[model samples]
Target: MRVLHLSDTHLGVDRWFRGAPTEWSRADDHLAAMRRALAPAFAGEVDVVLHTGDVFDRSRPHPRVIAAALELFTEVARIVPLLLMPGNHDRHGLSWHFSALPAGLTVVDKPCALQLAGLRLAAVPFLRDPAVWAAAAAASCAEGVDLLLAHQCFDGSTVPGFVFRPGEQPDTLGVQHLPRGGPVVLNGHIHTPQELRLGDTRVIHVGSTERTSFIERAEPKGALVWHADGGHVHRVDTAPRPMVIVRGPGDLRTVEPEALVALGREARTLEMEAEVASRGGWVASWPKPSPQMPLFG
Candidate 1:
């Protein structure tokens, strides 16, 4: 059995930054990336599409985002069976919002095990209460399960430059806490794709499809394709738009506009920081440069 594992699509996100494209453009990029990721399924290359979580950017997605999701998933469902679990961002009230999912799409809102084509799939959705989540996760793991799909952070998994905000729990679940010695664990939440071994089980982090921020610019954005017979998984690049950061010394007035425009043309989002010599010391300022502006200094 072959499976296409994808996660963290984060649809409806409207990121705003200097020299960045419009919100609609960013949304379109995500939609396009998802379609590219699903190409194998469209070509009958995979048996099922497993979406780990974070289907929408927010708990309550915008009407336009919902419409876009429906259109895309409906088409994808026609090609292959889709199994989606909700992540932290959209876990609170996802069922009510997506009550009318397409025919081939199955939403796993609760902890449960599904048997498909001689494989047991154990799915665990995001739960805010840690204790409840732990219990649900434990209960979801059943004997003879071939795969474990979850939407939570794992211990010892780190995304470079990721800083936890104040009052935000890390929500770390250790490998020992999970059901051991059976299924291959595939997880979401961490945008960076990774594979790790814990005891006798292998944990794979199915990364996000779209570059949500500058921090994720360097990470390879894509999905994982797993072949059950050979027990092999390969990463397939989904071609996410690039994000570029450019820094220079001088005030906004002295910065060259042509350079910013050139960089913006090459990347979907561009961030520029200029350091100017102040009376006391150097101060950093981020100026929004226009493509048609004059170039100086």
Candidate 2:
């Protein structure tokens, strides 16, 4: 059985750079990428579409974003069965809200086992508390081409360097706690994609479909195609609006307006860093968020 694996779609994400909101445009980019990712399914190349989690940017998505998701998934379900779970961002009572999802779309909000195309899929949603995660993990154990679909952080996963505020550390699931003996594990929650081995199990983080932050500019963005004997996956270039960073002396007057305008024309997102002369006569500088910031969804 062939499956299309996608995660961190984060629809309705309204990111800001230099104070300009690109929510609508970014949402459009995500929609376009979804279409590209689902092309094989439309052509009957894949049996099912498995979205690990983070369907919406926020717990309560904007009406427009909801509309967009409905329209896209409706067409996708027509082509193949779609299975989705809730991510941390939208994990609060998501099952209740989406309980009546349209035909061909199944929401795995709780620990459950689904049989799809001869595969045993053990779906697990986001569990904020470690105890809850442990309990869910314990209950999801199954056999036979077992595919564990989850939306949580896995220990030892690599991510772009970033400073986290106090008390903002993300919750993580230890690899040792996961069921062993060859279950193919697919995870979300981390924007960067990675493949790792946990004892006898294979773990794949499918990553985000679109670049959500400048820190992710260098990271690959895409989905995965998997089957019983393993399958191929590749990056999908959504071509998000360009983001440019400019550094200059503390004095804004020294920067030419024409130069700034030209850079703005080249990229919708622009960041400016100011450098100040230190007591030792050296420039002390640090980068700042673009006037607009990409807020966590």
Candidate 3:
């Protein structure tokens, strides 16, 4: 069985707070990139689609993003079965909010196991209670090929930096103890794609389809395509925009307006690090209005 794994879509997110581009345009760019990345799955090359979590950046998604997701999932469903589990950034409680989810999309609202293509998919949604989550995962995954899916923080990983959060299950309590019965585990939450081996089982994290934050500027953004029968994995790039990250300080105050403009033009996205000579100057550039400020009106 072949499966395309994708996660951390974060649709409707606009991380460009530097005022270089309009929010609408930045968000649209991400959505467009997502569509392009998913083109292969839409073309029918996979048997199942594993979406671990974070389909939206927030619990309340924009109407346009919701509409787009519904339409996109509708098309993808026609090609293959989609297994969707909510992440920390999603609405986990069984509520009317997710009522519009698409057909052929199986939402794992609770921890459960089901046989799919000869493998038992052990899935846990974003639960409010961690103790209950750990118990459920341990219980539901006792037999068959254990494909564990979840959105949580690793034992040593930090939230929104090293891990995803707002809601998270500690890795030690959940993932670390999963029965290693020779099943591949797929995860989504982290916004950078990575693959690791846990004994005989393979653990894959198919980061975000698009860059969701300025901090993630340096990570390679892509999706994971796994050939289950042969156990081969491939990465497909979906970062439609260039992300630039600069560390250490120079002086933004000394930077020419032309230089800043040029930097923005070179990449579709940009992040910068610099040292401000005065705290007053740094605070002055922030999202507050000041009589002495010329950067904002």
Candidate 4:
């Protein structure tokens, strides 16, 4: 009854170099982190592998990224069953590139329940509306320890800037919603791993396998391991790869080439904050003529 939960691998992330890393060296680090994340799933220490969502950053991943994913999951399938769901980042009915993903992986494009030898997996694809998930959960309620796999933000006031929207409910997916109580629920999309309880249900999110966004640079990157029969749940920490951030006012001329190069030396992503300083600092330019910008008139 052992289960390995992993998500938000975000492979083929080509965003970092769009702003920083002229040579795109950070892309290599991203691939390295992805490789490390999959090392354990194929090590034969678990019975099942569940990837809630966001297996790739883009729906149309490069050939190499797709090949790497196929190879990794192909090897993993040799040991255990893998369940993969599509996230908002990588949705279905869009790209044919991801169609080449390995056959051992069960891609859940629509809401459905999959029953394997030692587990029952109820997977839901990327749907912002909570009613969709609620209905799916209600229909999939069955005997045995059912594992709910989803990808969405959760509502937690403690974590600022990353709270679930009005429709997202951590309570609905917990044990209360299930006909039988006590099923392990694993989630993704929130770039930090979390464990909590909701009405006797053990719910957890493994976050992203790699820090694919600049906002997640300071957050922890890891995966979650749990037994389907409810033994013990633990979070395994993965090393945080190097990330870079760059910020300055809207004065590109004032920035030096050496400084920009130095800023990107050890970092992979950039967070630029363009600002304007006049009589009053940090004022945005008015597109239309306004009292604040009387000179434009």
TM-score winner: 1
Candidate 1 ranges with C-alpha deviation above 4 Å: 17-24, 128-131, 162-170, 249-297
lDDT of 1: 0.70
User: Over the stretch 1-297, how does candidate 4's per-residue lDDT look in tens digits?
Assistant: 777777888776653222233354344555566656655676777777888888887776667777767777777777788777888878752235555556566666777777865577777666765666667765665534367777765444124365543435533232334334656668777777777665666668777777765567567886767865546776656675644343333333343322221122222222332211111111111233232211101
The sequence of per-residue lDDT tens digits that candidate 2 reaches over residues 168-286 is 45466665567655578888888888887667667788888876665675676777777656555554444444332333323333333211111222222223222211111111112
TM match of model 1 to true structure: 0.79
Where model 2 places Cα greater than 4 Å from the true spot, the runs are 17-24, 96-99, 143-145, 162-170, 231-241, 248-297
Prediction RMSDs, each to the true structure: 8.1, 8.0, 7.6, 10.0
Q: What lDDT score is found at residue 142 in candidate 1?
A: 49
| Model 3 residue 228 lDDT score | 69
- lDDT (Cα) of model 4: 0.59
Per-model TM-score, in order, reads 0.79, 0.75, 0.73, 0.71
Count backbone overlaps in model 4: 0
| C-alpha local distance difference test of each model | 0.70, 0.65, 0.60, 0.59
Sort all candidates by lDDT, best to worst: 1, 2, 3, 4
Better of 2 and 4 by lDDT: 2
- The alpha-carbon lDDT assigned to residue 206 of candidate 2 equals 84
User: What tens-digit string does per-residue lDDT give for candidate 3 at 163-269?
Assistant: 43224543333344545464677877666666655456566777788766545655777777888667788888875454433222333444332121112222222
Candidate 2, residue 59: how far the Cα is off, in Å: 0.3
Better of 1 and 2 by TM-score: 1
